[model samples]
Target: MPRHGRLHIPGGCYHVMGRGLERRRIFYADADKQDFLDRLGETLARNGSQCVAWSVMTNHYHLLIRVGDQPLAKLMAPLLGGYAGHYNRRHHRSGYVFQNRYKSILCDADAYLLELVRYIHLNPLRAAMVKNLTDLDRYPWTGHSALMGHRKQDWQSVSEVLGLFARGLGTARRRYREFVVQGLEERDSDELLGGGLVRSYGGWEGLKRLRKEHVYCIGDERILGDSDFVERALAQDTLKVEQATQRIQAGWDLDRLIRRVSQYCGIKEEQLTQKARGNDLSLAKALICLWGSQELKLSLREIAHRLSISQPAASQWVNRGRKFCRELGIEFEVIDS
Candidate 1:
């Protein structure tokens, strides 16, 4: 069967995992790992995303990221692509570095944030990369050391993770450590990995019990959440799909969108395509970028070409446009079909 399209919800938290091609080692030395981390830090910083927990193993890596306005793909593309290029060049090897597109599970933060933190940080110990929790505290590859105050990573959201445990920094760290210790006995958790109905219900036994009780819960492989959360997310996604379809069927092409935005913003259509900077122009361009991609199903490359701007700039505008529309109560009126 074909894979499901990645579900992109702005500001959602995701548990992301990537493995090396053919189950080979992605990192051969400390330098390789350091390169990957450096790239990740830069990518997260530029994209305004937060990494609460991360672990880099020999063949794979995991990240718990709370995304900002842009889709998660914007952040992952550069990080994974840059690292893969760097790895291939340094090793004098060619071809793909990663097994495939990295896996990402949109998690219900309230339910799985702390659990995922513990699971990701404890990866080193589970793989025997570190002898024990004490060693894991000092282990450099995982974010555990940073949380434990044994190592410093300016990029990792140490405070955010610790803040969840306690108000005071020191007390929070202590409590966080205790929490990690308590989770050491947990075997590989399939529920944390994400799945459809079976994993969402907890396991086979949980499913059986629910079935016996005549209880039904919605689930999706792309999402890790309770029935309500899954239903809400799916509903939102369906609405977006329907809206996009309506826009396309209504003849919402790039030219028509540009003309409409220009008319709404009270600017000449030509001004939007020109290199200019002003509040009105910026907002107009942002709307074009946002609506063009979301409603008209235009790619960033296509949007950038139309606006005469770089692809990266187009992405930034999409994020800005989202915030602008939300804060200012801006809405686009559909043109007559």
Candidate 2:
């Protein structure tokens, strides 16, 4: 299988979303909704994550989560998949529950913070679940009420959004209430779902400025994370690959490899040349040395000189390792060397 790269984002702020398979109802009843919240609470406790915003729609959901030490996949894998299993078993259904893999976008918190909050809060309003902002305020299923102080949720991180709008809770709630209510009557300047980098910029000019400066983060649209964050994520990934290559390099020297194999595989170095290769440990040592040679780009002569064996013998060992590695999908040429 080909290597799958990690989705590199700029910063911690992310807008993650997913839908029910076939756009079916994700919440069939109040029990399903409450169970979802319970699972979310458990996930937050388990992963040590902060939930900035979220809303559970009938067929889809939205989230603005600050990723913790674990990758978002680690947390969601159990959360969503486990939930889907429960949902399916309960309803006598099978196969996928969510529409697809959750959509996650990295965001620039300073730039798109308020915009995201309003967008996330006003989902019910957009869907016409509420008649207007007045009804939205009284709606029980959305995060808008939580932000406005009309309702409360233990799992929601209200301070992040509240702090963005004002210094005090009372003032913040007042502003957020107004924002959500006002948004019901107005269309946002930018598309909340598309425009990727353009959304982060706030307008075409913002996107133009970033493009002019030549910034590209391995991030998706609908995400509002930071550029410096994107750079770091990509850089860390490069470092991991580089480190793996270094492991291969260190194991490339045939003489040293033979020594390591002799020590690790428990075959005396004297036996390496005698074709007395019945030892399992001895074979593994040879395999390691050969794999390292191919992965590290070591010359045949160099490998032969180090092993104190003919170039033909060294090449044979390397070939054996290459075939085995291809079959086993073992890329780390040196695990302990």
Best-performing candidate as measured by TM-score: 1
Q: What is the C-alpha lDDT profile of model 2 across 50-141, one tens digit per residue? A: 78888788999888877777667766788897789899888998888887567776654433556677788788878887788777776777
TM-score of 1: 0.64
The candidate that wins on lDDT is 1
How many clashing residue pairs are found in candidate 1? 0
- How far in Å is the alpha carbon of 25 misplaced in model 2? 1.6
Each model's total of backbone clashes: 0, 13
Q: Give per-model TM-scores.
A: 0.64, 0.59
Query: Which segments of candidate 1 are over 4 A away from where they belong?
Result: 1-4, 197-221, 238-337
Evaluated at residue 97, the lDDT of candidate 1 is 93
Clashing pairs for model 1 are: none
Q: Predicted candidate 2: what Cα RMSD to the true structure?
A: 21.6
